[model samples]
Target: MVSIKEGNSPDTETLILEAARKVFIRKGYDGARMQEIADEAGINKALLHYYFRSKEKLFDQIFLAAFKDFWPSIKSELEQGDGSVKCLIRAGVNAYTDMLMKTPYLPAFVVSEINRSPERMEGLLQASGVDAAFVMAVVQRGIDRGEVLPMDPRSLLINMLGLVLFPFISRPVLSRLFFDSEEAFMSFVGQRRQEVYAFMCRAVLHSSAL
Candidate 1:
């Protein structure tokens, strides 16, 4: 896990995007300022503006970068294996949890922006190459083979996502309320990769598959 502030090997655009991602995760869309991103990247605001014209454009680029970084590997993982419903769930949970652990603020940032500007985010998501229908089809195939219980693919998808997302999104309250320290909270979150996998199995797997 390289620090966002790693070696000066990255170009100026890469620096701005990494800096903007940190700022956006900390301050969110409306709250973030271009100057703050420049300061984070140790560049002048004029230079930052030279690269990205506006905060909206910067935010979009950051989200797109995250989606690009995330979706491809997970897509490969989902495409592999026995193509079982449980396998799909396992791959998704494991991949998402691992990514969230590395960038814990990502889910909250994405969710916040979507609520703030769903139309814009929808366009961005459409560009992200997340094949939801393919994932749903995996579940449908499992049901067709009598491997999982008959369930609405959409509902099952939402169920799996909710299980993976809730803890990270609710981090502030959950960290304080349920755990003594950030370390404890993160330890629990690390464990959730397996926990979520087991929970999804119980939620969707048929008796024989279980």
Candidate 2:
């Protein structure tokens, strides 16, 4: 007879986190339940608590990881390279969309969590070291180089993220209200991935006279 391991073990923490991620994405933070998470993890309530003391604690861990994963690509892209603003914007847009596509639920998960607890997000943002201030440094350099027109870098950053992320975050409503089909919505998003970069490049890089 082959020996088999029984019940939940230390490794079950990883299983719990995975299950938590799925549940959180599907249900959002306010709607998720400990019992549901335990069921999803194929474990009992006691084991769930053994891995994560509470739902809030579990969410905190998951949210921090998600935030870290989401922000770094844009940060690195902005911080690196000696290219023009057009090049930087295009690269950042592509990188941001690629990251979002790979983690489809991430935007909704983040927005839901932040809406639930803005203070918590503020603290996390402060600690993350990738805020408007850092992005502005990159944008200011472009302005100083005369590579881009004068504008509030933070406003531009916000607009860039909003354009790239809002469609995905509002996909269900957008699909139903406008596209009327998943395929149409997906196609639109695919097109926007390139269009967004082009729009940003044109808006930021071109002279006002043009």
Model 2 scores worst on lDDT over the 10 consecutive residues at 1-10
Off by over 4 Å in 1: 1-10, 69-72
Q: Relative to the unseen true structure, what is the C-alpha lDDT of residue 167 in candidate 2, on a scale of 0 to 100?
A: 90
- Give the residue spans of candidate 2 off by over 4 A: 1-10, 75-80, 208-210
| Model 2, span 144-180: residue lDDT tens | 7777778877777788888889998998999999996
Instruction: Return the number of clashes found in candidate 2.
Output: 0
lDDT tens digits, residues 1-210, model 1?
Answer: 545564443578788888998998898888988889999999989977677777777787887876565543566786778898878888888788878878787777777877887777567767986567788788889989999998888888899888888888899999999999999999999988888898889878998998
Please, what is the whole-model Cα lDDT of each candidate in the order they appear?
0.81, 0.78
TM-score of each: 0.88, 0.86
lDDT of 2: 0.78
| Clashing residue pairs for model 2 | none
